[model samples]
Target: MTCVSCRTGLDHCHGTVLLHVDGGAECTEPDCADAVLARHALVVDCDSIEGGCACEVTAERLAHAS
Candidate 1:
């Protein structure tokens, strides 16, 4: 799986916020929120994960949708 925040595609960090925009879903790690906001200049509804991170949550959601 790929991490949207670092974009490292490695399991280094977890995402904190799941950003839902017009086209697709994106995410940001706790430390990467500022960077993500700077890059994506669109209105997004942030979904907070209770125990999981955005990366894990989003992946699970996508899998279920499929």
Candidate 2:
């Protein structure tokens, strides 16, 4: 996977999520917010750090989806 931010392969660049966070304040997020949230959050990363995402693969997924 290549990082969308740096255009560097993930294997070479250190793994990190620029906007990653965990256990943030709970709120009733609207369903319509998925796209926006997905843009700002990493969906699968929640399992890694709890309520947070690592956005590492998103670039790859986005790259593939397109």
Candidate 3:
């Protein structure tokens, strides 16, 4: 599947897909998250990644660490 915003394949998109913690929106990319946070001053949470995506495993680990 592709990212709704970027049209990039989720499996190939760079950066982590994060959800805005304030119920704003899901970020299409990690850099997108940073940009949104910087621009709008909002905090975000990492959304569950696709199971077959390479980032899926690392995302879980990071989630647990935080």
Candidate 4:
């Protein structure tokens, strides 16, 4: 998948996760948010990190989700 911030193709980006609060689902890649929002879902980063792309927070949420 391509990064939402960088447009880089990533084969290992699945290590991240984004949670759509109202939709009760999570997206593992940057592009995943597109689908969640398309479903009229509400999502948040839900992760706190010092410096990185917003998508980087997915790493934290992914660990928690699993």
Candidate 5:
């Protein structure tokens, strides 16, 4: 599926999908979320399935050590 706002393919959106509370979906690409917001849409949630991006995991581990 493609993002409703940015039209980015699901596979190439870096696994970040922004969900509108009312309806619709978009990728988290640069300005993509802003585009959705410009339409007066509320992004109440998001799905991050980018398992390959370990930024979050590494941050968590470092935080725990601190």
Candidate 6:
């Protein structure tokens, strides 16, 4: 899916899926929980990275749990 605001297609984003909850209210659909987040502003780690910022997993990680 893509952001209705930014229109940035995250369809091809190849990372774990997770949720975006706020307070007692959920931010989005159950699909929102399908994304895996980094839990930090800009910090992440992968099992097998090729050649990228190990901590720069923003786009993917930010897809949820921000």
- The lDDT values for all models are 0.49, 0.38, 0.46, 0.44, 0.47, 0.35
Could you tally the backbone clashes for each prediction? 0, 0, 0, 0, 0, 9
Q: Identify the leading candidate in terms of lDDT.
A: 1
lDDT of 1: 0.49
Off by over 4 Å in 4: 1-50
* Model 5 CA deviation exceeding 4 Å by range: 1-47, 50-52
Q: For candidate 2, lDDT tens digit of each residue in 1-66?
A: 645644743222222223333333222234332333323333333335555344535555777899
> What is the overall TM-score of model 6 with all chains considered together?
0.17
Using TM-score as the yardstick, the better of models 3 and 6 is 3
Off by over 4 Å in 1: 1-50
lDDT preference between candidates 3 and 5, better one:
5
Q: After superposition, how far is residue 34 of candidate 5 from its true place, in Å?
A: 16
Per-candidate RMSD vs. true structure? 11.9, 15.9, 10.9, 12.2, 10.0, 14.5
TM-scores, one per candidate:
0.24, 0.20, 0.23, 0.21, 0.27, 0.17
Q: Can you give the lDDT of residue 10 in candidate 1? A: 39
Error of 6 at 58 (Å): 32
Candidate 2 lowest-lDDT run of ten: 9-18
Lowest lDDT sum, 10 consecutive residues, model 6, at 19-28
Error of 5 at 16 (Å): 6.9
Candidate 1 lDDT over 1-66, as tens digits, reads: 644655744333344335542235555645553435445434345444456445556776788999
The lDDT ranking, best first, is 1, 5, 3, 4, 2, 6
* Top candidate (TM-score): 5
Judge candidate 6 at residue 15 and give its lDDT. 37
Clashing pairs in 1: none
